[model samples]
Target: MATYLITGATGGIGEAICRRLAPLHSLILVARDQAKLDALALTLGGSHHAWATDMGQDGAIDAFTARMESEQVTLDGVVLMPPQPHADDNPMPTPDVWRHLFQVSFIGPLALLKGAVARMNPDPAEGRRAKIVIISGISSAQVLSHYATANVIRTAWVGEAKTLAFALGSRGIHVNTLSLGGTLSPWYRDKLEERAQKNGISFQAQLTIETDNVPLRKYGEPAEVAIVVEGLLSQFSDHMTGLNILHDGGFTRAY
Candidate 1:
């Protein structure tokens, strides 16, 4: 069984991934809330380790790596999904806003990857010895006026992932980004609910309006995301690397 470190282990997508991978692999769950992480580990019913780590905090990444050293947990893969600040809250951007956003969106994840490499690398195997998937939003591709900071910061990750793929491929490590869109996460559902309230319409009506452009006319399920992540981490995608997999419902227009 493989050992994987999943940052942002408390989110809906993160939870689904843990459930999907729990039966087959050993998991290192990381998040900010010790209580929540411990509860999740309990529910997963395995020897998974939970770490209450805030990756955005200074030195947190380094500390986490040190802890892993003590445990001697050699990771076979990593899933990066550190919680980002809600840019919608600060519609009017400031220098501090941009700096904080960049640090969280870009720098923190990069540090995570750097730490993950030491745990995953130097395998004698001919094929991939490790896989890393960055869980970014479709804002990396499409524009979201509400998430002003995200549109720019997340975009940088795509380029970074590509470069790392080429640099790390020879070491039997694969890196990719999974960009999601219109998923029924609690955050998205709340946004739809708010719109429905403002428009004096039913939630379904608002949802229909929001998803009109989607060919599937539906939001991808959390379980579906788990399945896709499973594919990315498994040997099924051994030949794939350095690519961004768009999980949007066929809405992105750019070629």
Candidate 2:
């Protein structure tokens, strides 16, 4: 079985991905919450291991590399699923928050990939080639004023993945970004609740507006997004790289 390294494995979409792949592969879960990771590990059974560390912290990547070495872990794939809809109540967004988002969304994933590729054996006799899938938001391409940091940083990360794809293609590592539209996950519900409370609107009313706003006439489920992610991580996509595959339900009208 292939071994997978997944960051942000406790988050909404991240959790979905874990549930989908846990039974099929050996999983190394990475997240900031030890308690949550431990709980997930227990629930997923013994084939999964949890590593609690803040991927955004300075030198975090190096520390993770050391841990992998100690564990003798070799990864066949990596999934980057950082926080989405990063928002703050600050009247003006601080530089720290901006930098934090960029670090988590872009730098952290690249660091993990750097470590994974360096450790993975290139011989096809070892197993299938390595793959890296980045879970990004539709806002990365769309203009969402409230989610400025995600918009800017995710876009940059997508570009970085494409560049890395070309450079790493010869090394048997495929890199791609999975851009998602609005999906009905815990994170999405939390944002809806926040919007409702702030606007003095009912949660149902807010949800109605959001669903109606989408061309698909409904919000996507986390499982739906997971399906797309699974496809990207599968062997069928071995020949593909440097692509931004969007799962927006046709919400993005721009060509």
Candidate 3:
């Protein structure tokens, strides 16, 4: 069985990804909370490993990469899910905000990818398969003034993924980005509740307002997103690379 490293593995969608991939792949769960990681590893009931590290910390990513390399571990795949920002209702973007965004969204994931990709077979003739799936937000493609930091960093991250796809494709690695719409996960539940409270409306009312923006007229479920993620990580997408798939329920009319 292939081994996959998943960052932010404790979050809603992250945990969904873990559940979807657990039966087949050996997981290396990376998250900020050690207790949560331990809980998830136990729930998964597998020989999975858990690494507790905060991506926002300066040396954390470096340490993770170094440890994996020194252990001579080979990663067949990597699933990246950056931690969700807390109540990004602020219109003004600060330097600290940008720094944190870049740290979790771009820098840390990039470092991990470098290490994971290095462990993959470089010889195409060897037929050793490898995949990298990145979960980004709709802000990557659409403009959300409140999510300015995310918009900038996510776009940059997608660009880097494309570059890496080309850099690694010939060596038998595929890299892709899944730009998502609002999913009714724990992260969005908190965000929606905050927005509703701010707007002096009920949670369900706020949910309706948000879903009205989507052509599908509803929020996506975690399992729905997980299925697509599974496809990207599996052999089904062997011919695909450098693709940015928008899984936003037609919220953005960007054809």
Number of the candidate with higher lDDT, 2 or 3:
3
lDDT of each: 0.85, 0.80, 0.84
Q: Model 3: runs farther than 4 Å from truth?
A: 84-92, 194-205
Model 1: colliding residue pairs = none
Model 3 scores a C-alpha lDDT of 0.84
Pick the winner on lDDT between candidates 1 and 2: 1
Q: Report the lDDT tens digits of candidate 1 across residue range 92-113.
A: 6888877777777678768877
Query: Looking at model 2, how many pairs of residues clash?
Result: 0
For model 2, the superposed segments whose C-alpha errors exceed 4 Å read: 88-97, 122-127, 194-205
Q: Sort by TM-score, best first: what order?
A: 1, 3, 2
> Which residue pairs clash within candidate 2?
none
> For candidate 1, which ten residues in a row score worst on lDDT?
82-91
Cα distance off (Å), candidate 1, residue 250: 0.4
All candidates: CA RMSD in angstroms? 1.8, 2.6, 2.2
Q: How far out, in Å, is residue 79 in model 2?
A: 0.4
Residue-level lDDT for 179 in candidate 2: 85
Better model by TM-score, 2 or 3?
3
Candidates sorted on lDDT, descending: 1, 3, 2
Model 3 — TM-score against the truth? Answer: 0.90
